[model samples]
Target: MNLSMPIDAVTMLLMTQAIALVAALVLAAEWRLAKVRSLAWWSAGFATIVVGSGMSVLRTADSFLLYVWLANGLLVVAHLLFAKGAAAFAGRRLPGIWLGVLLVWVALLGTDPASDRTALFGLVNSALVAILSLKAASLLLSLRRTSEVRDAVRLGHIFLGHGIFYLAKSGLIFMPGLFVSLVGFKGLLIKASLYEGILVEVSLALLMLAAVRHRRERQITALAERDSLTGAYNRRAFEAKAAAGMALARRAGQPVALLLCDVDHFKAVNDGFGHATGDRLLSALAGILTDCVPADALVARLGGDEFAVLLFGLPPENLPALGRRICHRFAQSGAGVAGASLQVSTSIGAAASITGTEELPHLFDRADRALYDAKRKGRDRMSVESGVDLSVATPPLRLAKVARRA
Candidate 1:
C-alpha cells in the first residue's frame, strides 16, 4: 500500500478529516468518562490526534518548520497525557512536573526551528519519547495484576503497539535529518516518504485498536463492580459507595443510616431443600429488598444470608419507620423457613450517624451490636440504635467507616 500511494493535497485533506473525526469521537467518550482517570489518557491521545493532524495539513517542508515542530510538540503532550491517564487508571499518579515539561516543549516547538530552538526541541522530543516508552512499559507490566487479563492485555497491546509505532515515527523523522548531514539529500526524500507511509498506516490501525480496547475495558470494569447473581453493586462496590456516602454526610453535617439484616435461618432451608430452591429463595429475597428500599438507598448481599443497606441523607426520625417497614415486609414474606409454619423473619440492626461526634465505623459498630442484641433478645425483630438518642443503649457506635482510611 505504501509503494503505490501518492502524497498530495487530497491525501492530506483526507488524513486531516479522518484524524479529526476519530479524535472527536474519542473526545466525546472521554468527556463522558471524565470521572474515570484511565479513560482520561485515551482522551489526551484523541486531543493530540486532532492537533497533530491539523498541523500536518497546514504545514509543508517549505513552510515555517514552526508549525511542523508544533505538531511534534503536541505529540509529546499527547503521549505525556496518555501516560498520566494510564497511571491514573492503574490507580497511581506520576510526577506533575513531567506534564509541565511537555507544556514547555510545546512552547519551544512553536518557535522557529532554524534557530537554537531546534537543539532544545530535539532534546525535549527525545526525552518525551523515552518517558512515553517507559510509561507504556509500566502499563504492560501492571497488566498481570488486573483481574481481567483479556481487557488488560488489550490495553497492553494498545500501549505496546502504539509505543513502538511512535518510537518508529520518531526514528524515521530524525534519521533523515541525521543522514542528510552525513550522506546528503540524495536518498533522504525517498527514505522519508517510505517511513511516513508506514507511520500513517500503522497509526490509523492502532487508533482503531485503541478505540475497541477502550470500550472493552469499560465493560470489564462494569462487570467487576456489578454482582453477577443479583445485578446490583457487589460487596466491594457497596463498601466503596458506603464510605463515600459517609464522607458526604460528614461534610454536609447530615445523618447516614445503615441497616444490616439476614434471612432468618436461611441455612436450614438450603439444607432441607435443594440448592436450586435456596437460589430461588435468595433471588426472591433480593427482589423483595430491591422493591422495599428507597431509590437513594444502596442494597447489597454481603454474602449468603447476610445483606446490607446504606441509607444516605435520611434523618434519624424517619430511620426507625424505615426499619419497621423493612421488618414488617420481611415478616409478611410468604416463604416460610424450611419445615416451618411461620413465615421467615429478618433480624435487623439499624444504626444512624450522630452529629459532630460519631464516626462512620462507630455507627456500623453500634448497629452491629444492636443487631447482636436483637438476635439475643429475640429473632425476627428490628433493633434501632440511635447514637444520638441513646435512650436505647445500642453498643457504643463502634463502627469504622466501611472503606475510610483511619
Candidate 2:
C-alpha cells in the first residue's frame, strides 16, 4: 500500500519526537538535582505524545483504527498526565474522574462502528487536550497567589495559551468549511495545527524548567533568611526586615515597636536537661511567639535564648500590652518541653519609635535595657521603655511574678 504524507506532517513527527527526547533529558536532570516528581510526570507525558504521534505517522490506509483509537487514546492520556504534572507542581491533586473520562472515550471508540472516524477522533482528542490544558493552566495560576516564584505567572500564561489553542482546534472541527478534510495529515488547517503544536510543546518544556529554577531560587533565599534550629528569621534577616519596616512606618506616620524577649533560666534548663531539650524549648517558644503576634509582625530568633519581634503601624501605647501578652503566652504554653513538666518563662523588654528615624540598634538597645529590667525584677515579667533615647526616664511597666532559678 502506498502512503502519502505532507512535508509538514513529517516535520511535526520529528519535532514531537525531539520534544520527547528533550523532556526526558530535562526529567533526568531534575531527578538528579531535586528528585522533583512533576518533571517526571511531564516527561512521561511528552514520551506518550511521541509514541502517539509516531503511530500517527506510521498509519497506512489499512491502519485507520490504529490512528483513530489507539493513537488518539495515547494523546488523551498524554494530556491527562500533563494536567496531573501541573497539579503536582501546584501541590494539588487532579481528580481521578478525568482518567475515567479518557478510559470511557477509548471504550466508546471501540464500540462505535462508524465508517468515518476522523471527526470523532478529532473531537475526542481535542476536547480532552483542551480540558486538561485548561486545568493545568488553572493550577499554575492558583499557585501564583501564594508562591514567590517569578515564573509562575509566565508558566500559567503558557498553559492557558495552549488550552486556548486546543479549544480553537476543537471548535474548528465542528464548523463547516474551516478545513478541506477531516484527516489530520491533510489541509492548511492541519499544517497550522502542526506548527502550533510544535511551538506549544517546546515553549511548555522551557517554561516548566524556568518555573523549577525559580522555585529553587526562592528555597535558597528562604534558607538564608531563616534560622536552622527554630525555623524563624535569623538575626540578620530580622534586622534587615525591621529596618525596612521602620522606614516604611516613618513615611506613613505609623508607630513601630520592637520587643526583645529572653527566655529566663534557659541556661538552667540546658544544665538540668540536655542541650537537645533546650533546643526543643527554644523551638516551642518560637511557635508561641509566632502564634501570639499579629500577622504582620516580624518574629525572629536573635541568637541563643533571645528572640525579637517587630510590629509595624502599632501604637506606642499598645507596646506594653503586647509585651505582657508575649510573656504570658510564653509562660503558659512554652513551659514544658517534649512532655517534660519543666517550668519556663520569658522576660520581654519593649521599645516603640517616637520617630521612624530611630536606628534599629538604638531601639533594640532600649528594648534590651527594658528586658534587663524585667530580668532584674523577676523572670516572668515585661518592661516597656517610653522613650527611644535613654536620656528620658521611662518608668518600667512591671508584671509582678516570683523570681525563678537561672
Candidate 3:
C-alpha cells in the first residue's frame, strides 16, 4: 500500500503473477461457456502475462535465458494478445504482417551486448507495453454504438491511462535525480508495476465480462424481437413499438394507421409448391411491406401468414393507398422469390384513428374488422375501414365462394 517504499520487489512479482493467473483462469472459464473468440484472446493475454511474471519470480542465477529473454518475449506476446482481443471485440483483426514484424524485432532485441541486454530489454519492454495498450484503447474508441458504448469507452480510457503510465515510466527512467542506481530503479519500477498491473488486470476482467454479458443480452433481445423466417418484427416487439408510436402520434396531433395483411391462398401455395416456396413467398411479402412503408413505420409478422404494418403521422384517407401499394407490390414480386407459376397475392385491411383520441387496441379492432371485411369481399385487394375505399380493385376471386356465403 506504501507508494514511496515497496514491501519487497520479489513479493510484488509473486503478487502480480498471482493476479494475472486468476484473471486468466476467470476469462478462460467464461470463454469455455460463451465460446466468444474475444474472450479467448483476452484469456490468452492474461495467461501469457502470468507465465512471463512467473519466470521473473522463479529465475535462478543462470536464468537470463528464462527470465530476460523468454519471459520478456511472452510479455510482448501478452500485450499483443490484449490488443488482438480489443480488435476482435469490435469485429476486426490485427494485421498479421505487422504482428510478424513485431515478433521479429523482439527476436532481434536478444542480440544486444550481454552487459547491456537487461537495461535494453527493460526499456524496450516498457515501450512495447505502452504501445500495445494504447493501440487497444484506440481500437475500442473506434466503436460507437448505443448498447456497448459505455463499457467500450470506459475500457478504452482505462487502457489509455495505463498506457500513458508506462509511457511515462519508459521515458522517465533516464531523467536526472530520479534513480541513484539503475538496479535500484529497476527494483522500484517492478514494485510500482505490481500495483498498476493488478489494478489493470482487475479492471480488464470486469470490463470484459460486462461487455460480453451486455452483448449477449442484446443478441437475445434481437432474437426475441425478430421473426426468424421473414426478418420482420415479431408480434411481441410490434405491440410494444406500436404503443410507443401511437403515443408519439397523438402527442404530435397526427393520425395512426394500422394495416393487417394476409396472404391470398397461402395454404394452397404451401400445399402445391411445398412449404419451402411458401416460406419464400412470405419472406418476399415481408420485404415488400418493409419497402412500401415509410422508414419510420413498423412492419411485424403477427403470426402464420399474417403480418401487420403500423404507420404514424398519416391521415385516414392515406391508409387505403398505402394498403393498395402493399397489395400491388407483393403481387408483382412474389413470383420472383418462388416461381413464375406460383401465383401469389395479398389482402390488406387498413384503418386510421383520430389523433389524440383513439388507443392502439381500439385502432387494432377496427383494422381487424376491416381485414375480415376484405376477406369476405374477396382476396388480393385492400379494404379501408374508414370508408375511403372499400376495395383496391375488383379482387381476384380466391375466396369468392366462401366470401359470398359469409
Best by TM-score: 2
- Sort the predicted structures by TM-score, highest score first: 2, 3, 1
Better of 1 and 2 by lDDT: 2
Query: For this target, which candidate reaches the highest lDDT against the unseen true structure?
Result: 3
Q: Write the per-residue lDDT of candidate 3 for residues 1-406, one digit (tens) a residue.
A: 6667645656767877888888889889988998999899999999998888777776654666666667777877888998999999988888886486367546755584456455556667778888989999988888765346478778888889989988987886555443222233355565577688888888988898788877888888989999999999999999999888878787889877888888988887777667887788889989989898888999999999999998887777666677777777777765586545555778888877767458878778888888888777776778877643456553463421111111
- For each candidate, the alpha-carbon lDDT, in order, equals 0.59, 0.75, 0.77
lDDT of 1 by residue, 253-276 (tens): 877777777766666655555566
- Model 3 score (lDDT): 0.77
lDDT of 1: 0.59
Clash count, candidate 2: 0
Q: Which ten residues in a row have the lowest lDDT in candidate 1?
A: 395-404
Tell me each candidate's TM-score.
0.44, 0.87, 0.84
Residue pairs that clash (backbone atoms under 3 angstroms), model 3: none
